[model samples]
Target: MALLGGIKEVPANQNSVEADELARFAVNEHNKKENALLEFSKVVKVKEQVVSGTMYHITLEASDGGQKKVYEAKIWVKFAWVLMS
Candidate 1:
């Protein structure tokens, strides 16, 4: 319990490497299952694609107390382009 929110973000782009790092961090913290699901660890990666413009990806990982105890998901940050342009 309470052994979360300490994982550092990967200094990379919107690629699979960042996603895996996020999963590892979440799994390490998920080992402790006493705390509630309120607190978790996440990684944010920002990338500038010449073809697609600028984008930000946020990956959140949490523990669910199941066979696949650890889970991570990502969402694209849409406002980065607006701010950049």
Candidate 2:
């Protein structure tokens, strides 16, 4: 069993849709912040640590004009609670 705050490995595939989406999100976010022109290729690895929400550690590959380089991104996801009357 993995602890909530401890990082745990997540099974990911380079050709998987979920992996690709996450990779794309990482690249897009980077481009937005750093004004980079990286193209998402695939995801190499993934890991997660749970806190109040979840923090994802994603290793991905992307192309910057020519060669594909590996980049790591940490994405934190926090879910909001909805109040139903």
Candidate 3:
């Protein structure tokens, strides 16, 4: 999976299930950072077939001192790689 940016090709054997799993894993990994305050983050949207791959929009929600905050992250998965910007 590509973790940064740029165009990437999706492999013929790749399927939506695998792509979704990878996207979820990537989001989990990202949320594990020390500065990450998000809790129960999940993939809210998956936009696919626009350019031979899938685009995931993840929603992260957190509570800070009783205040709720939300954030969005975009991930592109193609073939055997994942891209984030």
State which candidate has the highest lDDT.
2
Instruction: Report per-prediction Cα RMSD to one decimal.
Output: 13.2, 2.5, 10.0
Residue 43's lDDT within candidate 3 is 38
What TM-score quantifies how close candidate 1 is to the native fold?
A: 0.27
Give candidate 2 misplaced runs (Cα > 4 Å).
13-16, 82-85
Tens digits of per-residue lDDT, candidate 1, 18-81, equal 4655455445554556454434444444322222332323345443542223334433333344
User: Could you give the candidate ranking by lDDT, starting with the highest?
Assistant: 2, 3, 1
lDDT digits (tens) for residues 1-85 of candidate 3: 5545443445534454654565556556666765554344333344333345656554445454456666555666676766889
User: If the candidates were sorted by their TM-score against the true structure, best first, what order would they fall in?
Assistant: 2, 3, 1
- What is candidate 2's CA lDDT for residue 45? 89
What is residue 31's positional error in candidate 2, in angstroms? 0.8
The candidate with the higher lDDT, 2 or 3, is 2
TM-score of every candidate: 0.27, 0.83, 0.38
Go through the candidates in order and give each one's C-alpha lDDT: 0.42, 0.82, 0.52
Question: Looking at model 2, which ten-residue stretch has the lowest summed lDDT?
Answer: 11-20
